[model samples]
Target: MPKTALLTDLQRLVRAYGVLAGTCDHERAIVGPISREWIASEVEQSVLLSSLPAELFDTQRGKDLLAAELYSDRNVDPRSIDPDTLDLSELCRDRVINSNRIPKLEPQINCAVLVANMLLGVRLYGNHGAGVPEISHDLIVAAMLQDALEKPYVFSALSSAEYEIVDADYIKTWFGPNVAMLSYQIRDALLAFETSSDSVVSSARIANSLAAIFASRLRLTARAAGDSVVSFLGTVRRAEVVKKGLDPDSSFPERPYLARDFELAEAALQLAGVDHYALREPVENTLMIAVKDALEDETKRSRLSGRRGKAVHELHINLPVMEYYVASESSNSLETVHLASFEMMRSLEKGRRKSLSTMVAHAFRISAFAERVLGDALEPLVITLAMLHDVVEDGSAAVTGFDHSLQKIMFRFGAPIAAMVSELTDSSVKTAGAHKARMTYEQPHLISPEDQYNVNRFTELDLRPSDGRQPYTLSGIVIKLLDTVVSLEEGIRDPELMTDWWRHSGARIFWADNMRGSIVHPLIERLVIELKQSRSDPEYALKPHRVNRGRLRAGRALLETTLNHLDMYTTQNLAILSDEYQLDESQREFLIRSFNDPNITEERFSKLVLDELLTEDRLCRAMDLGRVPAKNYVTLYKKSSVPEESSDKTTLLSYRGNALRRKAIRTELGLDTPEGITALSLRHEQVLSMYDQKMSSTELKLPCDTVEMVS
Candidate 1:
């Protein structure tokens, strides 16, 4: 609602137009309050509308004897209030900021909303009138891309479609399907290479790989600045991480680095509007050789190769890297961006090194740390996938082509990393709108959980053979969730907003929208939220779990995120059955004779599997008593919160439903988990064994619980 000041301003403007008296007459006479209620209503509205909040309204406070405040014995003080300054007509209309529904849509869906907004708000919903441009395919595509890239800024600052309409005109039509003209641009870029190291890529073949993919994305995102692109690529080349002649050096200038770079430039032009396939090898190989020969590596040439695949992706911006660099004049804004990003990643600062040689080393270390943590709760290959999650964003990518950056990251890590990188690098994930990105990312196909578990998803991007028996495994499910958790933990700002965005999109797959209503949320949401808050804002001081600020309370706050009882039951119940059925050392001797019979269900085998996770007996009862120990500190407490004791607690009795979760979990672990799921558990030797074999989710879980013997 507009503040009373806004309404007052509107009315003041009306009065300035000599309509105040006229409006007053119209209100008192023809539109006169017919009933006592009507008169009372308008009078009360006049009074309430007069009071505006602080963010709005400036000076001058008086009714000026314009509209008299009438009281209706109707108790006006603590009730509904009317907007004073704004016109009643505009009051009911939705504000542009909150009017749109892009948050609820996927990339395809929200693009329509953006287009519509441009058509309406830009075209006719503006002060000047008819600002909308003629709709064209190129216009749609560019607008869609712009929506993805600048959506956060747009939603935050500009609301009128006209703002985008104005910006769209400057989208630089230099590189699209129109190629004949881009030849000049290419020639211009090639010219930059002629003079120095800019022309030649330095180092092992990886340089060539970086150059190749970068050229590809560059050609696709022709808007990239040639100079910035050169600098960024040059940065990678100068790092000297690879071996051989491919390294960057003064001798083999960037310009003469093989005919393939020029060829790739052409290929990029051909593949414009061709959704995927960002990187191809033959072209990459040529570029690698050229860049390699240009290198000045003091050491032996690297055995590492450039990323290999037919996968293509696109990225463009106002930086100096691509053909058209966008140097927004406000140098201050750029610093703010850097500052924000730096602050958001402060969680990683603790592990950083003081020396120069160890920066990348530190990154690898953190990656290893995340890997180890997830490994404990999940399978091994999946941990690698998680590590590769941030490799692309780490600044090594030169963006030579579509998905060039991601390809470079994959290449840097090798095949296993490449596979996981493939799954994590979705064009859908890089949305202009934060919520749009969330929607696409949360899609069942794109990602499983929140971004908090990014490393979890990275390892599982590719396929490994599934175990023949059961559908899914906990490791598989956890990876997806882990991927989500990592993303959310790092980039997301508002937890409430994050949850809302998740609900809007994740609802289809997750069913229960709010975290408080789910099993997983109760188990993990607090940690994620605390981590996110602590990292996002400097003021938020996060403490280890045992050190929570307050003492235990009655009906205390549990977890902001809670999974549904049914889902929890299914996952826990199945795990319990597997636990009891798989490991019976006493039955080992009998197993030789009973080899003819398969593993029996717990109920049929004279053993009952009770879930340690569920609260029925001692442990659960203690937990119910609010005397559970904190996860990080192991400190015990009581009376955490005495809920008014609602009838909400349900005993896990005769009920079952995990067919879908199991299906998704298994599919993810076998195919998506990196290195493939041969085994499950945190034990090092066992983990190494699992990494070597491709086991079905059931086979992995079989030994995990049901089968305890060697032969």
Candidate 2:
């Protein structure tokens, strides 16, 4: 038979078996106990003849192939033959006959049949037709018997039965060139599935699965390493249950695990030598249907429903909410980004207290902003960094020290993530020294000598570079911008923090201006407008007490003088400026000038600094921001308008409820103006974009159903 015809016949046979087994209790029972090997053979001649279309099996050659006894006795009833009860020699008899070679002891036959089936499935379903040779029975039979000649010791260890090892020459001499040539390919798929299965069953190997999964997902190279990425994910799921102080063997009600299965299936398929990218849409569609059915069943059982609300009320860190947030925010992000979000959340759970929700929200907001602004071209690097940007900096040093945390990130995630995080972390003693000197000069009473010593020691950890701070990568700069934007938003939403937020915003805006002409420039432009608008709001005006006003004026004066006199905006230069202005005649002159000026109102100073002093080209040169290469910046501004109302009533209701809550909060904060409403609407649109991306990516619609269930 031709290759296509043969594959079509085989696929029909498997599909027919699936349908028949679903309806027939006896067939189902027989399939339930045996391994995948016996199940492959379970597409018996009778099932083929009865279940498949008559035209498919009408040919005598097809019937002959299906009805061939091969090494097994044709007269025997398959229903009566118990695979578990069969002798090892009896299992090896087929391999012996197929290979036409006899070793001193029989080689193991554990994965031979399953590996053959998997290879055949890959040929049938994968996109290997253009350059691949035609399939033949010799190749199929070789695949089936390949495992018996290779991996003899592995099988012996697995089954606790002695087996003689066979060499490549034996395979070539006994089974011909096909088996010898294809044995390695068979071994790759075999070991991938085998190791994955082993990880699922063996307690000793469970801890290593997370690292394996992380490496596989990051590099897409775990297939050759004998690790099934999907299986590791499953093992990690169970491990998470254990971490939650629950029994690993017990059932856990969660949808993220199911969603992750769908999400990671493509990676698994790719590892198994399937052309997952080419088949992604169809494969995801099929898996989505299966998952939706599973979700319906879980919903009927009340397993997925109502749990989020209960968990929210009872748990400090509502995992379902967190998972939903991360999934939605990372829906359009890369696999690495998605994985990093989970890792960051796991790390945060160890050290964070009441600030857990705030931190998580902030991280996810940064991730969301990354996807919206940068798109997916640089998503893997930028989004991963965005998610983990604060793991070392914000985590409690007692729970996980800075080095330990950073090394763990490097080990689990990769060096690039750790490096970017280190760059982003404010861990340099040099930076601390600069901050300390500036603070001492600006407000000497605030930092006692002991506090200054602590700051110095904190910076001495050397988590970052030793010589000086390395310039930020374009990704690091984008993360910093997003972080600032999120902080500014938080400040805008909370009236009590307005004055402090304004001060911080001023510094950050200057930092942003110094980064003009980079990919983050557009974002900076938007931020400047928002800051200007927010600063103009009389409700959120800087109305500090007299003492704080004096301090603010002095700080502004110090900042302006430093910017005016400094040649380059490096930390070294800033430190020198602070020292010189503190000790020299310039110190008294600066203090006198700052206190003497009455026209430098907060608004006028901001206008002068933002509009006059810090033009784009000037600060860009002063800071040498263009030293780092710039990438094309993308924006979703047009896409940020409110999305069309979802056809899903449940989702629409949830969106409206969310909008109402946001409106209520803004109203309470006295920020319910037209611009505020428009900004919130844009945010609402951004969330819907994430929601849509997540729905498409996972191909699972649990969110709409989840909302209905929670309600």
Candidate 3:
């Protein structure tokens, strides 16, 4: 799918009108990426009296057909209506003549398409089992027209009397009463749909299905700025995840809460002029299961490749609707990433680095971090890089093999992604023996667990930064920084555990040192220098914009919070697990003596002895007490009125209310706590009061003392 195909004439026309009238950004996100084929097909088969073309709007016959389509009742004078009133000349003139408040045209187009398609989808597919109403094509045409007609009224460009002259009733008098009525209904529905939080699953499913069909029809490739096509696609994907009973939240990058499947489905159904119960269970069941299966199994679709003799899978916007059926597994964008990720997993299996699952997690987190900072526009590329970042180095891919991977990436995705991934692989990690080879097993030790701990803590390993390094491209730097952040986040979880886990390499250097040993060392150094300079150097500082600063700050905060929670959890686990086993005095003495002997150290010993000592009785008793993070801190608690107040007259009334208020205290902590919030409030109170008496000694006749109060 090429990017150009998604931008159709219908989209342009709709957007132009939307810009002139002004539509909300969220509404635009929903309204963009409508399928021209689907709309035309619906218009062709609709209960419409005629399918008027752009040119036909100029003819009397065209006006008659349009007027007929608009009004089912058909009580109107068509001859009195001038089709010229439907023309966009005034809107264009306004854009040309005016200097302020002009909306970006492309975004408007995308918004218009989304809204128009969604409206039609709701009308057609959102059946309440009363069967779809005799929906008129006027709804489709009126989508764009209504926005234009309402523009003057919306922007206050026309006065009340002037608006009345071209109001619904007036226009209907010239056009037709039915047309006017239908237009009002559509306009109202649009508003209701945008604002309402009601659930209507059938309508959402249908709307998503319609958008999927449109995406497939247009083969939408490139992301359009200010359009919700990318996000809409993501929403559909999330819906699929929900339909499959998967958690929609991304743990790697962390996402704010999203609505559940039932909620989303219900919302869609409501917007589509249908009730939830009206939807057939059989249809819903099939949509949930079979449609997804069909989407996953289908594999015949093809897409354009940047290289000759190489075609990739077409972008799949999977919908279970008969019209949306694509018989290719690779038809959708989700499938493409899934396939790539699967391949990456398999590659890691051959030469596993930090376990296949952990590596995959890293990839997901990296991609997620990228998406957070860069926005959705670069998500696909960023994710692809994350997936393949370690393949070449960790998988021990040959030069020729890497070249092939690069070629495959270029042909399948694009060059930009291939370039980024190429830069992500730290080739130095593979060439030098900074880290142990995958095949080389660690030497078994005769040390006791305590001795092993001592060795892990005291032994200094020869870890050094790679001297051979080069500069980094901006794209490469972005990915590496994200990679470093994610890696550190994981490594920070019990730094001791990490050191123990990689004990073979000694505890002196861990992730940071390991990174320094790789090709990314110089890049990290450069980044550090830049960051330090950025604090004081105006030229080196981040772009002077809230958006840029906010993204960086927010991303950092989220990463830190997540990292802290994970670290706390792991530390608790370690504390409990460590107490599970203990050596008796005599056994400990013998083991320590044996471990001290260099000859005995050469003999392999088993840590299994300690594991066996941790019987169920001991483990169960330890667990009975529970393990929780320490929470010995003070926090102010407030009450409107304490039933039993302390024996003190320091209480104060709340400013706005007459209710008595006082500070209280509470303390508690829990393990496995998923979520919560704590509030902090500040107050000032007098610590002490004093009374002082002053006497002027110089005044001979005055033995008077003056009293003063201090607060």
Question: Which 10-residue span in candidate 2 carries the lowest summed lDDT?
Answer: 98-107
For each candidate in the order shown, give its overall lDDT on alpha carbons.
Answer: 0.25, 0.32, 0.31
Please, what are the lDDT tens digits per residue for candidate 2 over residues 259-325? 3443444344444323332233333333333344444553322211111211111121221222222
Clashes of 3: 27
Predicted candidate 1 versus true structure: per-residue lDDT over 1-711, tens digit per residue: 111222221121111111111111111110111222221111100112222222111111111111112323444431134335536334423211110000000111111212222222222212233232332223323322321221221111112232332122222221133221222333333344333323543221222222333343322211111111111121222232123233333332223332334444434323322111222333334333333332334121111111221111112111111112111221112222221122112111111111111112222222322332332222223333433443343322111111224444433333433444443433332221222223333332222222323334544444322211112222233333444432222112111111111211122122222221232332232233333444465654442322122211100111111121223222322322222233333332232112112243324322232332222344334334433321111111112323332211111211212223332333432322433323211222322222223212222111111111111
Per-structure clash totals for the candidates = 105, 0, 27
For model 2 the local lDDT of residue 443 reads 34
Off by over 4 Å in 1: 1-207, 219-281, 284-372, 375-380, 383-474, 487-492, 495-711
TM-score of 1: 0.21
Tell me model 2's lDDT, rounded to 2 decimals. 0.32
TM-score ranking of the models: 3, 2, 1
Whole-model lDDT for model 3 versus the true structure?
Answer: 0.31
lDDT of 3 at 361: 43
